[model samples]
Target chain A: MADFEPTIVAFCCHYCAYGAADLAGSMRLEYPTNIRVIRLPCTGKITPVFLLRAFEKGADGVYVAGCLEGDCHFIQGNLVAKPRVNYTKKLIQEVGLEPERLEMFNMSAAMGPRFAEVAREFTERIKNLGPSPLNKKNRNKTDKAA
Target chain B: MVIGERKPFDEIMRMAEGLKKIMVLGCGGCVTVCLTGGHDEVRVLSSQLRMARDKAGNPIEIIEKTIERQCDPEYVDQVESIVPEVDAVFSMACGAGVQFMAEKYTGKPVYPSLNTTFVGGSKKEGYYVERCQTCGECKLYYTGGICPIARCSKSLLNGPCGGSTKGKCEIDPDVDCAWQLIIDRLKSLGMMDRYEDIMPANDWRTNRDGGPRKMIREDFQR
Candidate 1:
């Protein structure tokens, strides 16, 4: 609904979010196409460095979708990822970025509708916030060209 | 091995002022094994420093490098090429490494990002315990291989005072009495009679009390 099209990265768990994405396609549940998903073995493998790197590389919104609590295929993978998300949120905020740009969600592989719902909700949120201030370099060049 | 922790980010930024270029030196020895000054930490600190500098309107160029051992001159000599280009160096190694870097680069200022703790060993995977004082004295044979200099709260050599209650030291409720341990170990070895000999006070002159201790082998010098 707005000119700002947020560049979103979803670090999806291989066993859950990845499967759920496939289910969404199978069910024909349509969502925003701007989201790029990176499948990881488990959410625990997602370090704070990797999350910061995503933000540094022009990601307007970053989300970590892991298995439900106590339901992770790798014991406490989701649990480990939960605190790291909170830490990275604080770090991003300290660096003058909106903390809400980073989000962590838990869902099962069977929740195809929920995945689509998340995509829509997150896209709307980012659209309301407008473009990331860090991407001003690209915006300025585009504005001058126009 | 000495155990230490990284300084706060704000403090590190304050110490890094006026430097347009920085070289973050990381050690792959004790600090690396302790997870404070390893390659991973070097990258994180470099990124954070760069971001902080940029945010402060003073973008700094930083080069991240790590060595196998910072205390060894050979390992530190590897930075000869980059040391000349950087305005300053921020060492994440122990105090010895920081001093070594300062000595190596006479003109450039070298700052330390970590507080040097003491010669210790890990109690657990992530926990460390001070075990030696490097007092230039070896009395472990009589004390059942435990250094009273570090283990004892007061560095007492003969025995623990009445402050020891139920195997715990009075200084720290969580710490076990070093003298109690010495007695137990000696008893187990059927050598409790060794404790009867009146041990004299430790000679402080043998340590840093003599102003920077040093040792050399005359036979090997040639």
Candidate 2:
């Protein structure tokens, strides 16, 4: 279990969270290397289907990082994303996955340290939760075929 | 539009438990507008089922299709070519759509994935409230455009029984008393005198008591 490295997918809004990630790199901030961020035009573009697809395609954990509340570049994109992320959390739970595996975070472009902090925290959470059950089964199938 | 809700996930899974391959049929009519049995829901449910089955190591192949209107034979006929290819069909439409699919493809098992809840319109986004009972009789004129038969807990024709208090139904305090709404609307319309007119015994035969009602237009028939 010590060697277990969970694969995490983070859907980051272009206006804030994505820029914060880039800034984190420029500032020499160190975050876990487990997460792969997919930049979105807005957090509003992150639908429940995308979240579920991420899990189905073997993401151990997923999160949406959007603009700070009332600071969305498109006015209410982050506001709308809040409820959608919450709903998808419930949906993943219904699919027999832990609701904690999916989450939503808010921050502005200047918060590079906060972005790194979130990445490390979420990666730690996923490591504790271990690999997704779907991923395990898929791996077992491939191993047998091999 | 008619309102429908998805059945519980476990219950739906059980319906297709042993099947290897199945078709998830979605409706594009009232159920689509209500967000229960539409193309989007079909994709969501299909993806969820695939993951669930994959996790269990008993993966099942799913075929997805959404017809224009499941209640119409012309639309259901569109799936005739694909019907025989699958072992069973999990219909996400209302009861009428499920039955129509079953009738069209006899010998093939058709299961309903949604429960036909009611004939109503959205009170707001994602919120639906019943407004009609399809009693085969139109009584909206007598009730100030509200249907007490559907909204009233007891479905009483001469309503606002002892159960009504302060415009709320006794059955559920949150529900507005149908008769109260009727009286209020009539008062605003200056037709309160119409309430004094007695309503005779309802003809139950016109409703479900008539058993499997149907309408046939001789002029429309070829």
Candidate 3:
């Protein structure tokens, strides 16, 4: 049996990634159910605080999937999202978590299979990393002492 | 906008580490426009600090407050009522605000949570690029409004250096060549002929070189 299912939060941009997810559903592509997707108007709107809030609320993994660069409905939205993701990764590292837990991907609405593929790949990666040390279901308060 | 970025979380945490309770002072002036040390950033920084502390088993108490302008003594004076209750303060303002907080609450240790980056202007949303050095004098009229002190990598006063490739800086590949931008702006404004004249090298004495600069406008003075 799988050791534990990671609770991953995927912030999908409405223009592309969210549409791609809908396409995945229509195509009947199977992927890990661990991911909980939140649709955002644009990936650029996702701030550093949202990423921190995700960890604070006990998400095992966080993913931001946006439209391909230059394809964002709102021009340069993906570009803005890129630096923010990089900055937040540093914050996560500073808080004693592996930076790899936070990931960003670029995909188009037509890439339904790619969405499922990314989900499965991220799920497997998190599994190998084990449950988030912050996941309260699998850990106690003393685990946070550093 | 006073463009700046928050200090590394761990580094900031270390600065405010031993305090049981601390006040976070946010600036509502330049930093507010830059989205660095404004009221919203203060709230988020305080929350993040609290969480980091809790995770580390430290569990600190943070009180967030914003002043209209931390650099002004009139605004900072308001903190006196709240200052006595906290063990320390984490100033989220610029270098000026941080120093003002330190001066206002003399006995308490004041820490800076943001790195004072530069005097700059916002480009498109969320993109702030340096635009001025606050030199005691203004020469923007001669350069068609672009500031050589801040934008140019070398702060070239006259024209684009020979090293400019395409329209990018030679020192850093990612930076747009400032001189190139100035020329474009001047040409668009039909002021290209004016840019042909060479500018004298900057006189550092008039800048902060003579020491921290100050100005008194008699016209605006009481």
| Model 3 lDDT at residue B153 | 82
Clash number for every model? 0, 0, 0
Q: Compute the lDDT of residue B166 as modeled in candidate 3.
A: 94
Model 3 interface CAPRI class: incorrect
Q: Candidate 2 on A110-134: residue-level lDDT in tens?
A: 9999999999999999888887887
Which regions of candidate 3 are displaced past 4 Å? Answer: A19-30, A68-71, A107-114, A135-146, B39-48, B64-67, B73-85, B122-222
lDDT of each structure? 0.84, 0.89, 0.85
Q: Is candidate 1 or candidate 2 better by lDDT?
A: 2
Q: Let me know the DockQ for model 2.
A: 0.43
Fnat of candidate 2 is 0.42
B64, model 1: CA deviation in Å?
Answer: 1.2
lDDT of 2 by residue, B33-91 (tens): 99889988887788778778878888777888999999999999999999899999999
Judged by TM-score relative to the true structure, which candidate is superior, 2 or 3? 2
Interface RMSD of each: 6.3, 4.0, 5.5
Candidate 3 versus truth, CA RMSD in Å, comes to 5.5
Docking class of 2: acceptable
